[model samples]
Target chain A: MSRVCVPRDAATLAVGADAVAGAIAERGVEVVRTGSRGLVWLEPMIEVETVAGRIAYGPVMAKDLPGLFEADFLNGGEHLLRLGRPEDHPWLAGQTRITFARCGILDPASLDDYRAHGGFKGLERAREIGPAATIAAVTDSGLRGRGGAGFPAGIKWRTVAEAPGETKYIVCNADEGDSGTFADRMIMEGDPFTLLEGMAIAAFAVGASKGYVYSRSEYPHANATFGAAIETARSAGVLSDFDVELRVGAGAYVCGEETALLESLEGKRGQVRAKPPLPAHQGLFGKPTVVNNVLTLATTPWVLAKGGEAYAALGVGRSRGTQPIQLAGNVRYPGVYEAPFGLTLGEIVNDIGGGTASGRPVKAVQCGGPLGAYFPPSLFDTVYDYEAFAARDGLIGHGGVVVFDDTVDMAAQARFAFQFCALESCGKCTPCRIGSVRGAETMQRVMDGVDTEANLALITDLCETLKFGSLCALGGFTPYPVMSAINHWPEDFHVVRDI
Target chain B: MTSLEPWRPERGEEIIAGLTRLDGAVLPMFHALQGAFGHVPKETVAMIAHALNLSRAEVFGALSFYHDFRHEPPGARLVKICRAESCQAMGGEAASRFLLADLGIDWGETTPDGAVTVEPVYCLGLCAVSPAALVDGQPLGRVDGMLLVEAARA
Candidate 1:
């Protein structure tokens, strides 16, 4: 008999999975394991193969299981929850799936389930190739850090691996403090073993004996999931050589930065440190550290498992590999969708996201997190890539695209960008600390129509100073939203000038 | 005065005593004290200083550096509204205004009844839903003004 796989989406696994298992078992069919498809709303998405295709059903609750079973639903009988083909669904069809390749395809906590669906193949491959060869594979893949800052991942590993030190560390920045971004949280919670396998590979590559996952305290579920995953990995011998521990952060936005994350991990206040000596040299208690975002490290094992060229061939221009793009807010289909770098903002916002849920015209889409720039409807055609976004005064910040309808106020948004920086500023430098508060005040003046022209000029100058003088992006890129809002939606600013 | 009287037994004394025995315990002691009593009380700070043989100023500076440490007590319900970009992109401003208007208080201010204290949080990692907010540290996503009020009331 053909084995069928049914996912436990949002509801309790035993209630949902057991019912499906019991129903299928009664038919003398075997049941298999798989992870969630990340479309949380359409949960308990059941998949069964027939001569026609892989039939799928979703939003299936425990109460509906008996009816589904009575109809022999395992063999793809017509039901209210029936979705003909899993791959044919527009939501799943458009995704590229690099970091989240195994999600919804394997049982999250099961190592055996993972291995069956291409888990640890990267680690096993890394073990054969050795550290140097492994690093070369990543370098060839052209994989940049997916943690907002698009730094080369291989070069970072090389620095830590080559660093002449006995005590090295691998720190995963699971402190995803950016709004409109839950890729890290989803990866950790849904498919934690992949991240564990990836981190273990990094530990081996960097010759690091210890690894730490600095997860945000805001994601209690993610923290619990990661904590449990670490324990499971340790007992399963996957993390036998390297010790992995999870440190819960007390919900600080600045902790998302690599330097600030290290400070937080050290049990100090989450504040950004000056970088002359990068974390590669002085990090995590003054040891050579391989600090990478969750997505960056999660992609490592895959790079080793598949050839670097295979992964490199996926994206356009300087950007390579697939990004776990989160399609969130004011959209009909708000969920995680993976795609290559070449897709345009219009395609993502309209095509994939199915436009705004409000049925109003799409006004603007904010690419990246809080520090990212907001693109007006005019620039909707702009391609979604690192270099393209940077050219347009934006960054593909952690692949977060927040859609906004015409109801959004550009002036308020501009003011909020400054306010956010002021609140999150680590106060390591004056430009960020003093400049942000000044920027907020100046933006407020512009909004209030008090000396509007002078206030705009002052805000522009302040942004420049903060960009040039600040130590990190928290201060540096705070102006992206401010300038973009002013440039695109000039009418929003209370300027006295007549056309 | 009666409420303040219970604090005379060195409010966080048990926690302070437990943390004091560890090696390099100064930092851990302060953390434990803060964990026990939302913020490090003056008496607890003094006791920690005496136990760790560190100055009161040293303990105070440590307390001041961390954002989690607060000088005043939090309300029975702590509502943290996400001010991050995604939340902002999804009508967070309107939500904030509605909350302020409905509650008759601005962000970081407590209601007159001492029932709820609303503060602005950068992000709660519920970006997909957008316009997210948290009440008493429990995350609620895709929130509106009515939702915030309902959460506050609940």
Candidate 2:
């Protein structure tokens, strides 16, 4: 009996993965529902277990099943949509998928399937070597927080482990509110067991007995899938020492911030609190806690399975590991691509991305989320490293690259940056709340062709205030998009000036 | 899944009682109420405050801060369109214009017949397949105005 597979992830389902699965179920072949490969364009991608490996076909619709059956796709026969061996595809072949190794290729909810693909090996290894060794492996790997801040992950675990407390908590920040980023969602939806296992390992490493996954309400699919994965982990005895609760964040972008997330987890308004009592020292319900991003926690299993030095040997400089770059917008090959840190913006956006879907010359690339800076083609040479992006006044935040074609209005984009800040700011600080509104008005005056030069100066000055004075990155980094627009695309800001 | 029918008073009391022992139970209580009753009703607010020992004013203050907790029930079907940066780069504004013109409604307005309520969401994490929208929480990607209208109908 041939085993056929179709994606059950949210994106694939949105594109009718379930319909394809339903179409295949009637065929009476042993159909296995699997996770997505993140080759989103080829989603509803069907695979059959062939003598050679898994043979692939794709973006398959319910109506196409009859033709596929006739084509002998079960035997890897030729078909219009046959993608040959999926891993061998040029778009996916170059990826160094240590963290996402089993993502699209395995049954997300099946423990047997997960174990077959090297799932719990990291946890087993962590158990053998003990907590200190696990932390050492992560530290030696130079793993930083993939959740924007780039702080050392091992240091965070060490603090929680060493903190004096009767009870400590491990919190996974799954509040992935940043636009143009879907890596966290992909992992949660595709290979949820990995996150489950990773959280369990973090609990063991830090000597914490309880854990909480704070995911936003926007991702209902993720909530359902991850909720199931937790039950599987519990039954499998993988969570013997660790207990986890899944908390949903109501629609609040500021909740993505660590402190605000903590507040929301405790059933309060997602508000930013003062520091000095860092989460590791005093966190959820005023207890010692270790807070880490979904990606950061998900990556830990791989860091343990493969030695820290082995993981560390991949990327250039301080980056030290492969970053999962999610390509979006005008890019032709918009999917998840993981590579070592030294790859330039051009290599990822142009070579890997295959330029804009419209076939127009690429005008700009937003290297992070809404708050990330906009870059022109001239800066395409910049490397994908924390320090490198920061040097260019950008941050390799969560590795979300949103491409823009030549038709974009940079001035309008700048206004949106300020407008977004004003809308999402936690209002705990004055500079963020007032400066964003003032900045939007300043951009409008420029568009209105009134005092254009001084208005430009005012926008720049306002950006400086928001950058330094704001309480959190929500307000602090609004300047990245605004300043970069003025610096690189002054021609757009020159809108109808003195006409 | 915002519903129009009023939630049971007894069910709301059970929700508050079930979560009363948790460290900070207001938000969870709100989520429970919203889950049971399409939106948090004014009567339930006082019920939750009384059950959880929080002042009614304190409960209202917390409820309004976050955008997810709605005060009123929505139409039968909900339509959410992404107006985020990724969608914008892919002619998202043009698509939005088409839907707005065709439906005779703006971003947050509901149709007069109460068939659908249209709203703008920042991002659906479907940026890889740009120009996305969600109808009743099921996503539609690489969507145009026709696809969006169809999604709403679906």
Candidate 3:
């Protein structure tokens, strides 16, 4: 009679969560492998549906289960590990969760569980109103691409829908290579049906019979979860009109770029292609294709279910809808924090994140993954809006907020950014290919105090070239960190001269 | 450190044939080969090329371009450490340093004892519990020098 929820998320599983789930199930409770609630700090977070409410016991290790059982956990019993009523928890109670509303709340692969919790409502609505209306609804919703570009989603969909081709394609860019981002992975692993439904809806809207979810191999669990979900959807005949297949990338960061993703999809190296024969015009084997980030596609079902105006009602400016901002790194409370687009960086780092686990003052925060510009404590008031970030030489890239404490060396961090660029560059363009190596070496000189002023200037000059000269974001955005480090934390660079 | 299973030509051909029908079948075929055998065997280039009507160089070009595909054999265990900003902010660099020192091998090198091979991965999305590392593809979160060393040793 007891329904137990255990997160099968990768972070949870890494800490022996699977074994813990197995142990709990053997204790005579009906176990449900649900998606993570994004409360990563309290992972393998177990919830038992009891008479009182869903009593939670989190971060439960296999070793902790015996004590939980002894405490009579099944009956909502008292225990040190107990966190009663997940909703009442301050973390869950505070913010808007429209995008991730169903995440960690339902059994990921269960179509029935998904349906019970407002699943397929968007697709049903889309089907009822037809593709043209569905596209119009999305257009009205004001949902821009969550994949860093901030292009309108409905506009992109309409392009593929209207493009001249009987064979159109819906490609989900689940290759989330950005360091601080995990929203795409979480959606695929936790509520895969939503992503599947979104893709199916997209295929229907575009008149495409085929779809592909190009997930990164880094997320083995996500890839597996999505693969199983596809099979489940396939069996249930949910994919009658449109078919979806999962494709995986082999550790290529550039593959996250839409065009590069298309290249990799064609079974080739992930190299950035020239833009203007946009993927919409000629994509995926010379067919019109609609490439969207997982977050964008996943958000579609909701926009359809609720009218676009209703969805667009929230947030500020041109940036519409909510962002599933991931609070990562040194923060005390690290997890996915979903909120509207206008919250300040200060609010996210201090309030939601609860500051660094190191107890040091937050020195800086890097939003939108590594490609995003670093914000000093002074710029904490900066808003999370796409245009706002762009105005400040930053980006709300995929809503990943990586917080750093005073102990962090900005110079070293800058060097690593270029080094990462050097390591991951697709080797197609010269500026990124050559500039990154030089930038990294220059950063080291700045670090070593070798002609500090001159080296710093050289690093600054080199970054500009990489910023404008590189072929893709990998090279183009590496300068963000380097420049931000120099601009905001010049003291750190100056201190190296004393060293 | 888990090395790919020794390539069986028949099995490689079987994987290639099964996947060659899909659009952009080459990538899928390479992924399947790596999934079946931890690394795609060099022999797969010609087999996959012939099946997909691609040149061996084209196949090899793809195999070498992506960082995930390993060429030589790995060790008994694989330790992929997260060196991304999130991890670094949470002492990931220190954990990696400890792991490297403890194992007496640099990044991307196998231990002399062949106990483990270390590779620096960008991120594993365990940023919430920062300083994450993957020991044999199993993630370890909230890692420290001691934990990373223990992971490498294990």
For model 1, residues A32-74, the per-residue Cα lDDT tens digits are: 6455576644655677766676787876666777787776676
In terms of lDDT, which candidate is strongest?
A: 3
lDDT of 3 by residue, A1-499 (tens): 8888988888888767799889987867889988888888888798999998788998788999899989989898899889889988899988788879999889997899999999999999999999999999999999999898889989998999889968899999998888888999899989999998899888888899999989887788898898999999999997686889899888888899999999999988999998788999899987899999999999999999999999899899999989999999888888998888899998999998899888999888988888788899899889889988899999998889999888888988888888888888888899898998988888888788788899988888888888888878989998988899899999888764445
Tens digit per residue, CA lDDT, model 2, B112-144? 888778878888888877798878878778889
Candidate 2 residue runs with Cα over 4 Å from true position: A497-499, B1-5
RMSD of each: 5.0, 1.7, 1.6
Question: Between prediction 2 and prediction 3, which has the larger DockQ?
Answer: 3
Candidate order by lDDT, decreasing, is: 3, 2, 1
Q: Chain A only: TM-score of every candidate? A: 0.91, 0.98, 0.97
Instruction: Provide the TM-score of chain B versus the true chain B for each model in turn.
Output: 0.82, 0.88, 0.92
Stretches of candidate 1 off by over 4 Å are: A1-36, A40-77, A495-499, B1-62, B69-78, B93-105, B109-117, B135-139
For residues A418-478, could you state the per-residue lDDT of candidate 2 as single tens digits? 8888888888899998999999999988988889999999988988999999888989999
Model 2 Cα shift for residue A496 (angstroms)? 2.7
Tell me the TM-score of each prediction against the true structure.
0.86, 0.97, 0.97
Reproduced native contacts, each prediction: 0.41, 0.70, 0.80
Tally clashes: model 1.
5
Cα interface RMSD of each candidate? 4.8, 1.3, 1.0
Q: By descending TM-score, how would the candidates be arranged?
A: 2, 3, 1
Q: Candidate 2 chain A — worst ten consecutive residues by lDDT sum?
A: A490-499
